[model samples]
Target chain A: MNYPNGKKTNNKPVTNRKPKQTPNFSNRGMTLEEDINQSNQAYLSSGRAVIHKKPTPVQIVNVDYPKRSAAVIKEAYFKQASTTDYNGIYRGKYIDFEAKETRNKTSFPLANIHEHQVEHMKKVCEQDGVCFAILRFSKLEETYFFPAKKLFQHWDRQNNGGRKSIPYQTIQQEGHFIPLQYHIRIDYLSIIDEMYF
Target chain B: MNYPNGKKTNNKPVTNRKPKQTPNFSNRGMTLEEDINQSNQAYLSSGRAVIHKKPTPVQIVNVDYPKRSAAVIKEAYFKQASTTDYNGIYRGKYIDFEAKETRNKTSFPLANIHEHQVEHMKKVCEQDGVCFAILRFSKLEETYFFPAKKLFQHWDRQNNGGRKSIPYQTIQQEGHFIPLQYHIRIDYLSIIDEMYF
Candidate 1:
């Protein structure tokens, strides 16, 4: 079979054994990062939005300037990002969000988010920017647009002996489920429109 | 003499040299970058604004993992940034700007800004984000907040027998002059408030 980007899939189907349940199209082994990137590209190309994933920060310690072409970094280390991964202007409002995927079936663990990121999101929200987390349950093939305000409520309650993880039921009830689309892939802005606009 | 950051001045005063006019206190031998960073830090601490300098992007080519320690990137290359150097949410709006310093006292050269950066700023402005360039005349110790709209006007006219640089007099007349403060350093936000608010 041929994929959308013209790469031919070579995984042969095994007909000798009993067939398993139909594959989950939503969880096609492509990560949430790739899906969101494709969606952002679509959004940018259509002039609908201008959102970008920030490059991973690396601290360079040394560099070598060899003759002409380009200077090469010889020593570096990955640094923790102080803010969320995605941010941009969307319809005259600042849009900022982080994305996380969890394999756990029942709950979204708090460990998935860094304290600094939570604090950053709080500041962004305080500035009245549209802030949220894109939570993906890979095992359940479900994705959600979880608002930062709701996340803050859970984050604060954890200090007073509340649950460390958000129960799947709460997410399903409160979070907006991001609908999957053909070309758009993860259609998150539609949810934003419904919630904010 | 001691500098603001506690570094001892080593250069002796030259009594034989012709007396140059008293040095501009605003420049203070500090790069525009350092000033902006200090300003941003103060803004963050005071809850006046949420702005940050984006990390310089590097492309990792190789990594080495030593026992019981974090993985170290052994080789990488500095990557050109696709967007402006600084961006953040301020006053419920997206703020993006690039800072440039020039020693020329007559005009700010167009060569200091990359074509792609100009395109990026134009796009940001089109999206209703407050986009501008912080132009510093290092020799004159004057800094101006040049709006991207005004910049685009000059940039586009360069093809039609227009000057290749923005005259210092024009900047003085059109751009908002950023004042230097003790703690705030380059207080560009005041200019933003005046223009945007």
Candidate 2:
């Protein structure tokens, strides 16, 4: 088919481009973000864990009070996150981490992180808090739980003239890869129990 | 003055109008929010505190990718926070609180708080973490650290046919009033140490 812009169009090709329906293969279905969010809900509902996604930052500009009991915000801006994405207390020690998923097949780039976040994690580490990063390789369908120390090692590697990213083999060698499951999804704290507790 | 449209041009006086400069008052010269934020920075810089303000929530709709490295949000909505403005770990306990400033000369209004936040605080309390409200009566130039238990008492009073609002006298009577300071601004941990530690 051809459009007014004179470019050929075909829905069949675009539809065929879609990956397998299985979440394990496709980046869309049961994404890590959605699964982790569900896991958090399950944790809270079952009293198994108390964790939550912090609210996104909004710079509220105006509010319209159409009714006495309700105020509607008119404008706002998204503020950059100053700390890690997730945090909570588990088995007494404070838990903090940033979860990242990459489509790259070769190496996980360090550019995904912010300097202030690195410094924040370092501070959390100093306070004896459990801190780390959870990396998911969507292309490989693999998830790895890496300690803050290891992340820092890779984080500092960029400054010391090391590679700007960690290779897949390096993560597979040093990191504890988590097994995906039907229930208790992510199941990262199970690894936390073995490694930390 | 009457406008050409015959609208009275009335400037309706607003109620419970808090002062424009709520972050600074002469009695302490610094509001508790400023103090805690500064203290959080000090803690972060000196490797002593890891607490931080979570990202402000923004309901993002459109994004403009001026460059691949930067994504600028174009449209969004502001979400009311489910929890307090800040939370983190100090000495192995989760620190959580909602900081507010009131100008009332006699009592603080309950309207400053939301129902969901109270529920969230209850959960924080159940987890044995420190939860409280740092209320600053800017006009009175006073800051008080009221425990979650105490706040819950008054919060529940609303359902028990008790006063919905807490009186200034009652706060001074039951809450641990924080001493104003020059350097260790809003030294509330001192109160925490006496009550909790």
The worst-scoring run of ten residues by lDDT in candidate 1 chain A lies at: A13-22
> For candidate 1, what is the DockQ-based docking class?
medium
> Candidate 2: RMSD over Cα atoms?
13.7
Interface RMSD of 1: 0.9
Against the true two-chain complex, what DockQ does each candidate achieve?
0.63, 0.23
Residue clash pairs of candidate 2: A56-B56, A56-B57, A57-B55, A57-B56, A57-B57, A58-B56, A58-B57, B43-B49
Q: TM-score for chain A of every candidate model?
A: 0.86, 0.82
Flag regions of model 2 displaced more than 4 Å. Answer: A1-28, A58-79, B1-32, B66-72
Candidate 1 deviant stretches above 4 angstroms: A1-25, B1-25, B159-161
Model number with the top lDDT = 1
Give the alpha carbon lDDT tens digit for every residue of B130-158 in model 2: 88998888877777788888888888998
True contacts kept of each: 0.79, 0.37
lDDT of 2 at B120: 78
* Residues B76-180 of candidate 1: C-alpha lDDT, one tens digit per residue: 888888889988888898999999999999999998888888887877777899999999888777777888999888888885778899999888777877765
Question: What are the RMSD figures for all models against the true structure?
Answer: 8.4, 13.7
